[model samples]
Target: MLQNFLVPDVLTHNYLVNGFCKSGDLETAKWIIIDMLCRGPSPNCATYNTLMVGYCASNDLDKALDLLSTMSTCAIRPNRVTCNILVHALCNKGLLGEATKLLGEILEDKPESKTANLITSTILMNGYFKNGDISSALAIWEEISKGHRTRDVVAYNVMIHGAGLSLHHSLAYRFVCEMYKKGLMPDVFTYNALLSLLFKEKKTTEACYIHGVMSKMGVPPNIISYRVLIQGLCINGDVDLAKEYLHIMLEDSVLPDIYIWNSLIDGYGRHGDVQQAFYIRDQMVASGIFPNIFTYNALINAIAREGKLVEAHNLKTEMIFHGVYPDVVTYNILIGAACRLRHVHIGLLLHDEMLKKGCHPDIITYTQLLKGFCLIGKVINAEILFDQMISSGLMIDHVPFQIIIKKHWRMGELDKAFENYQIWLRRDK
Candidate 1:
C-alpha cells in the first residue's frame, strides 16, 4: 500500500498513525507522518491532525504545537478538528489564558468555519468549570448561547455538568428548561448532572423525581445513571433505596461495576449492617469481581469507626494478602479510629507503618496524631509531631494549631499556649 501512490493510501496511513498513537507508540506514529511528508500522497490536515492528537494524548503539548507550525509551513490550513484538538489539549494543561487566546485565533481565522465554534467554546467552558472559574465558564456559555450556530445539545450538556460541579441547582434547571425551549431535548447526561447536583444539595426527592422523569421520557438510564443514584443514596443515608436501585439496575440489564459494588458495601457498613456489607463483598467476588483498595478502605472505615479495631485489622491483613495495599486514606482511617478509641500507641504505630509503606503522612494523619498525643497529655510528643508536619511540607491548617493551643491551655501552660497562638497567627497571616 505504501509503495503505491493511491488516494486512499493517505487515509490508510492515517488510520495506522491513529492506531500507533492510541497504543502509546508516538515515535512510530511520528515516523509514519514524516514518511508520508517525504514520499508521495502528501499528508493533509487530517494526517497532521491525527499525529497532533497522538502527541496531545501523550502530553507532548510542545510537540503538538510545533506540528501546528509545520502545518502552516506545509500550506495546510488548520481545520475545525485541528483547532478543537489543540484547544482541548491546551485546556487540559490548565492554560485557560492560552487556550482562550488560541480559541479566539482559530475562530477569527476561519470566519466561514462555524462548525468548530460550538465545540471549542464548549471545551473552553468546561475548562473553566474544571479550574473552578465559574464566572468565566458562565461568561463563555452566555457568549455561545447568544450565537445560534454555537448553541447545541453538547453545549447544553457542558452547562449542565458545570452547574452540577458548581452546585448551582437552579442554574442547571434553567439550562434544562432553556434546552426544551430551544427544541433541544435534555439528554441522559442532563439528567445525570441533575441527579449529581440534587444529591450534592441533599435534595434527594428532587433527584429521584428527575430519575423518574428520565424513565418516563424514554431516555434509558445508562450505568452512570445508576452509579450516581446508588452513591448519592448511600451518602445521604438512604442505603435501603440505593439497594433497591441496585436490583432495578440489574433488572434493566445495566451492569454494576466495582464502583457500584463499593458504594453498596460502604453504604450497608456505614448503616451499621457490617454483615450485609460482607454479603455484598461475597456477591461481588462470586460475580468474578475482585475487591480493590477502595473496597477494603470502605469496610475498614465502617468497623473502625464502631471501635472494632480487631476486625478492621483482620480485614487489613486480608487486603494485604490479596495484594490490595493500604494507601494514605487507609492509614488515615485506622489512625483516626485509634485516636478516638484512645489507642494512641496503635495510632503512633500506624503512623510509622504509613512511612514504611512509602505513604507520606498528610495533614489529616498529622492532625489525628496531634489530637491523640494532646489527649494523652503527651505535650512534648505533640510539639515534635507539629514540627515534623512543618518539615514534611503539609499544609498547616487551623485545626492543628487549635488542638495544640487547647492542650497547652488545659495544662495551664499560658506561655506555651500564647506562643503557639502567635505562631498560628503569623502563619495564617
Candidate 2:
C-alpha cells in the first residue's frame, strides 16, 4: 500500500521512522532517514529527535550524540523528546554526572518546560536508585512530591525496588505505607518486589506479613509471588511450611512450575531427606508437570551425596531417555560425585561427552575437573588441562594456580613450581 501511494512527506517519513524505531529496526530506520534526506525534504527537529530516540532505544549513546551534533549543524533545534531520550540513555549507562549537566542545560534554557520537569526528575530518581545512592533518590522523590501534583506507578515501583536492592527493607515498607497515605493502592509489582526481597533476606515472617497485606488489598498472588515464598520457606528449613504454601497455592488455582518443585526437592535434599524428595518428584510427575534439568540435578546431587551411586547413575540415564539433555552444571555434579566415589572412568567418560556436546567448560567446570585429577594423583593430566585452559584464553585464578604449584612442590619439582610461581607473581603485580 505504501508503495502505491505518492511519495511520502516529511511528517509521513517521521511516522515511519518512529514505527521502525519502536519495533527495534534501527538500521532500517536509519536507511529510511537517509533516503528521505536524499529526496530533498530536509529532516526537521522532529526527524532528528525521532532518530535520537531510535539510537537511545538501541543503547547506542555515541551515535545518538553524533546525531545531536548533526542536528546542531543543520540548525534543527532539539525539543523535549530529544532531551528525554538523551537523559534516559545517560541514566541507564550510569553516567549520572553527565545526565545532571544535561538537565542543567535544559532548565537553563526552558525553566518552564513540562518535559524538563517530568523526564529530568524521573531520570535522576531512577539513576540515583540504580547507582545505590539512596539518599539522593529520596531527595529527588521529596522534591518531586513538593512540586508535582501527580505521581505515577512507575515512580513508586522504582523507589520500592531501589529500597529492596539496597537492603533497606524497613524503608521499603515505609514507602508502601506512604503509598497508602497518598491514597494510591499498591500494585502487583509493588508486592512482588517486596516479597522477593524479603525472601532473599530470609525474613520469612516479614514476607508473610506482606503476603497478608497483599491478600487484604485484594491483589491475588501471582506465580512469582508464590515461588518466592516457597523458596524462602524451603531455604529456612521450614519444609513443612513450604509444603503448606504449595497446598495453598494449589487451592488458589495457581499452577506450580518446575522451579517451585525444584526448590522443594532441593530443600528436602539439603535436609538429607532423599526419600521425601523422591516422593515430591513422583508427585510432580503425577501432576503432569515435566521435570527439567534442575529437577534431575537436585535429585542426582542428593542421591550422590548420600552415596547412592547406583540410583544416581540410573537417574542420569532416565534424564537422557526423557530428552532432558544434561547441562554444564549436571556434568559438574556428576563428575564431582564420580571423583568423590573414586570412579575415575565415569568422570573421564562424562568429560568426553561434554566435549562432544560442544559445551564450553567454564572456570568452575575446569576447576572441578582439575581438582578431581589431582585427587586421583593424575598430576600430569591435571597439568595438561591447566595449560589447555590458559591457551584457550581462560584466566587462571590464584586458588587453582596455587593448587598446581603446591602439587608440583610436593612432588619435589621445586624448580618447575618456582618458575610458575614467578610468572604468577608478575601477573599479580
Candidate 3:
C-alpha cells in the first residue's frame, strides 16, 4: 500500500527509515535515507536528526558527529533534537566532560532554544550524578531553579533518581516532597525512584506502601515496578512471596526478563530449595529466557550444598554445551565444592582446565585449593602449591597463610606453625 500511494517521497521514506532506526537496523535506515535523497525530496534536519540518532544509538558517535558536517554542507540546520542526541550519547557513554562541552556549544549556538537548554541541563545533571559528583549535580539543579528556565518534572525526576542511585535516601525523599509541593504529581518514574530507594535501603514495607499509593493514585506500574518488588522480596529471603509476585507479573502480562529469572534462581537456591532452583531454571528456558553464567553458578552452588557432586559437575558440562562458557566464578564454585567434598584432584584438574582456557586464577582460586589440600592432610603438597602461587606473583592473602599455619599446628609442627604465623604478622606490617 505504501509503495502504491507513497511513491518514495521523503514523508513515506521517513516513516520507513524511523521504523528501521527504532528497530536498531541503522544500516538499513541509512540506505533508506540515501534513497530518499536520490529520489529528490531533499532530506531535512529531521532526516539527518533521525539518522544521527540511529548512529548514536549504535554507539558510533564519530559517525553521528560526521553527520553534522554533512547536514551543514547540504544547508540543513540541526535542531534541538540533533544536539540533544549527541549530548545524551556522550552522557550515556560516561564522557561527562565532552557532553558538557557539547552542551555549551548548543547553548551558544541556539541561545533561545528552550529545548536545548532543558535537554543540555538535564544531561549535565545526570552525567554529574553518574560520575559520582553529587555536588555538581545539585549545583546544576540549583542553577536551574534560579535561572530563567523553570524546573520541569523531568528535571525533578532526574534529581530524585540520581539521589536514589547514590543511596542518598534522605535527599531522594526530600525531592519527593519538594516535587509534590510544586504540584508536580509524582509520575510512575517518581514513584519508581522512591520504590527503588526503599528497596535498596531494605525498607520493603515502605516500598509496599509506595506501591499502594501508586495504585490509589491510578499510576500503573511498569516492568521496573514489578522488578523492584521481586528483587526486594528475594533479597529479604521471602522466596515464596517473591514467587507469588512473579506469578502476578505473569498474570499482569509483564514478560519476565533475564534479571527477574536470575533473581528467582538465586533466591530459591539460597532458600535451600535446589529443586526449586532447577525448576525455575527450566521454567526460564521454557519462557525463552536462556540461562547465563549467573544461572549456572547459582544452580552449581545449590547442588554442591546438597552434596550432589556429580550433578554439580554435570551442570558445568551442560553449561559448556549450552554455549555459556564458565567464568572465573564458575571455576571457583566448582573448585570450592570439590575441596569441600575432599576431591582435591578434581579441584586441581579444574584449575588446570581454567589455565588452559586462559582464565587466570585469582587469589581465591589458589586459596581454595590450599584449603582443599589442608583438609585432606596433604600439608606438604599444600606448601608446594603455596610456593608456586608466590612464585607466580599472586598476592598472598591471609586465608592461604592461615590454612598452612593451622595445618602445621594440627600436625604437631609447633615451630613451623609459629614460623608461618610470624611471617604472616610481618607481611601485615
Which candidate leads the pack in TM-score? 1
**TM-score, cand. 1 vs. native:** 0.93
| Candidate 2: count of backbone clashes, pairs at least 3 residues apart or interchain | 0
lDDT of 1 by residue, 304-325 (tens): 9789999889999999999899
Better of 2 and 3 by lDDT: 3
Q: What is the TM-score of each candidate against the true structure?
A: 0.93, 0.72, 0.85
lDDT of 1 at 139: 86
Segments in model 1 whose C-alpha atoms lie over 4 Å from true places: 1-8, 145-147, 390-392
Best by lDDT: 1
Which pairs clash in model 1? none
Error of 3 at 383 (Å): 3.8
**Model 3 lDDT on a 0 to 1 scale:** 0.86
Worst lDDT 10-window in candidate 3: 1-10
Per-residue CA lDDT of model 3 for 1-429, tens digit only, reads 555775666777778778898999998988876776776678888888888888887889999989999898888887777878888888888888888787767767837656558877998899888888899889877877676776778888999999888878799889889888988888898888888888888888788788778878989888888888888889988888889878878987889988888899999988899889889888999998899999999988888887788998899999999899999998998899899899999999999999999998999999999999899988889989987886787778788878888899888999999988888898789
Ranked by lDDT, the better of candidates 1 and 3 is 1
lDDT of 2 by residue, 1-429 (tens): 457976678888899889999999988888887887777467888888887888877879999989988888878877766777888899899998888777777766745655456667777788888998999889878877786536666677788888888889888878877888888888888889888888878888998888878888899889988888888889899887898888898898898998999999999998899999999999899989989999999999999888777788899899999999889888888877887777777877888988999876677777777777877899998899888877877777887788788889989999979987987898788
